[model samples]
Target: MRYDLDTRNRALTLLRDGVSNAEVSRRLGIPSGTVAWWLHRDRARNGGLPGAHRSTCHTCHGDPLDRTAYGYLLGLYLGDGHIFQSGKHRVPNLTIACCEDWPGLIDAAEDAVRRVFPHNSPCRVRRVGCTYVKVYSKHLDCHFPQHGPGKKHTRHIQLAPWQREIVDEHPWELIRGLVHSDGCRITNWTTRRGKRYEYPRYFFTNVSDDIRRIYTDALDRVGIAWKETRRGSTPYNISVARRESVQVMDVHVGPKF
Candidate 1:
C-alpha cells in the first residue's frame, strides 16, 4: 500500500509538472495504462474531477443530460472510491421533477450547507428529487442501542443502507443524545390577579446514556437539586430546584470569553 501510494503521488506530481503520462509510466517502470488509471483515480478522490467515467466518448455524439440518465451517473459516483468506505449515506427519496431540476437544486443546497456546516467539506450530489436529494459528506449514521443485550433494538428505526454504509465506514462519528424542551407556569397564576401564572417544567422526549450524563453534569455544576418525574399521558420531566437561577453566562462560554 505504501509503495502504491508513493508511486501514485509521484505520477500525480509528474502529471502536474507537465510530464506526459506515458513518459512518466516508462520512467517509473510502470505501465502507461496503470499510470492513467492512477491519475484519474487520484483526481477524483480529491474532488478535482467527476468521480465516475463515461461509458463512451462524447465526441461522436452529444452526451445525455437527462435526469434519468444522470441518476445512474450519480449512483456510480456514490459507489466510487472517492466516497470514504467508512462513512455511510442517507437514502433520499427523490421525485422525477426534483431530479430534473437537480443542477439548480444542488446550487441552492450547497449554499445552505455551507452556512450550517461551514467546516464541512464539499459534498457531491449523488441523487436528487422534488423533495429530497442525497449528498456525499463526512456525516455518519447514529443508532440507539436496544434496551437490553440479546435483543434487537427495534424501538428506533435502523439506519438505511446508505446511512449504514457511512456509519460502518466512519464509526467514530456516531453520537447518541436526547432532545429536551421545557414549559413553565407563572407563580401568580393561582392569585386572582395572577393571570400569567407560570410553572417551570421540562421534559425529555428521548433518553439515552449520553442524555443522562449531560443532565447530571449540568445539575452538578449549578449545585441545584433535580428530580426526574413521569406522569400520565405526558412524558418524562425533570424538575429543578428553584432556590436560585444560575447565571446564563456562567453556564455557556462565548468565543470572546
Candidate 2:
C-alpha cells in the first residue's frame, strides 16, 4: 500500500528524535520495516541529513509538489481554513480550525500541513470549542493562490488550472478532505404504517458560493449525485442523499472520526 507522504515524514521525524524503529512504527501504526527503511534512506542520502527548511518548498527547490496531500489539503482549505500574515516578518500562517468533536480530523489536518511543509513542525492551539492547526511559511501563497484580503464569502475564490488537475486526479481524496472539514454524515428517521424508516445523507455547508461550486464540481467528477439545500439563512448547503451516492461515500469518505 502507498502510505501518505505525511506518514513517512512523521516516521522519519520520530526516528531522528532517537526513537527506535519499533517505537516509531508502533506510534505511527506503520510497519517496522517501513520505519527502518525511512531512517536508512535519510542517513544514506545525506550522512545524517539536517531537517527540512522552507527553502526546500517545491516552489523554490523546483521539486514536484506532493499532489496527493495537496489534493486533500485543498478541500480543507476551502472549507474552513484561513491564511494570515502576521508578525514583523509578515510570515503567513495557514490555520485550519478543526472541531474537537472529531479528533481524527484534527490529526489529519495537522498531518497535511506537515507533509506540505515537510520540514516544519506544525503546532496546535486549543480554543473553547475547536483546535487550530497552524503552520507558518512565506510560500503559502504559492500553494494556495486563493488567499486574499477580505472574507472568503465576500470575495471571489477560484482554483488555478493546475489545482483543478490535481483535484481531477485525486477526486476522492479531495472529497474526503472537504467532507471531513465542513461536511457530515447524518441520518433522519420517521415511522410510517407501523414501520420505521431511516434515511442517511451527507451535507456540505459553506458560505462562499464559489467554494460550494468547487465541492460540487469535484462531486460531479466522481459521479456522486448531489442537490442544493438550505441551512437556516444560508443557501449554500449541498446534500448527497441518493442511496448509491451514499454507498460510494461510505466506501471512500464516511463520517468524521
Candidate 3:
C-alpha cells in the first residue's frame, strides 16, 4: 500500500507533535507498522530526528558562526572553491583547490573548514597538481548565496551584509585565503648601480572582476595599497609592490610555507 506524499507528511506532522505512532496511525487510519516505518525513514534522512541536522548548520541553528574562519573560507571559495549539489537531498559539498606543493596550506585549509563547520569532517582528494579540501552540508547555500549555475565569472558575486561584516572584521584572513588560492609572492630582480637587487612582490590573479574587487576591497580595509594590471590581453591581477604595502602583506598574507 503506497501512501501519497501528503499522507506521509501528515503522518510525520502528527508524530512530531507528540502523537505516538500507534495513535497517529489510528487517527489517520493508517497501519501502525506503516506509520512507524515512515517515521524511521524520516529520521534516517534527517540525521536521526526532525531538525537534527540544523545543529551542524549555523544559519539553521540560529547561532553565531566562527566568523573569522568563515570569512577566510569565503575568500577561498570566491577564489578557487566550488560547490556541487549532492544527490536529490540538495546537500552541497564545498571544495577548495589547494596546490600540492603547500602542505602547510593544505592543513590550514582543512583546519579552517573544521572550525567553521561543526562536526563535519573535510576530506582531501589529490589530483595532478593540486589537492581539494571538501566538506558537505545541507546549508552551504545559506552560507554562500553567491553559488549558482555556470562559471563563477559569469555570475554576480556579492557578499550579504552579514558576510560583509565578517570580511570587514577579519580582512587579513580573507586576503590570506585569497592569496593562497589564486595569488603568489615572486621576486623580481634587476641590476641597479652595478649591483643585483630583488624586489619581492605579491600578486593575486583571478579571471572574475567581481572577485578581484572583493579581494581589493579587503586590501583597502587593511590599508594595503595595490595596483591592478593585465598580463597580456587576459587575467586581472592585483599587485602589492610598494614597500609599505609589501610589508603589510608579508605580515598578514605571507608566502605559503
Which candidate achieves the best TM-score against the true structure? 3
TM-score to true structure, per model: 0.36, 0.77, 0.80
Where model 2 places Cα greater than 4 Å from the true spot, the runs are 1-52, 231-234
What is the C-alpha lDDT profile of model 1 across 74-120, one tens digit per residue?
22222111222323434321111123333553444344334322333
Q: What TM-score would candidate 2 get against the native?
A: 0.77
The candidate that achieves the highest lDDT relative to the unseen native structure: 3
Worst 10 residues of 2 by lDDT: 47-56
Give candidate 1's error at residue 147 in angstroms. Answer: 13
Best-to-worst lDDT order: 3, 2, 1
Error of 3 at 13 (Å): 15
Looking at model 3, which ten-residue stretch has the lowest summed lDDT?
Answer: 49-58
User: Order the candidates by TM-score, highest first — what do you get?
Assistant: 3, 2, 1
* Clash totals for all candidate models: 18, 0, 0
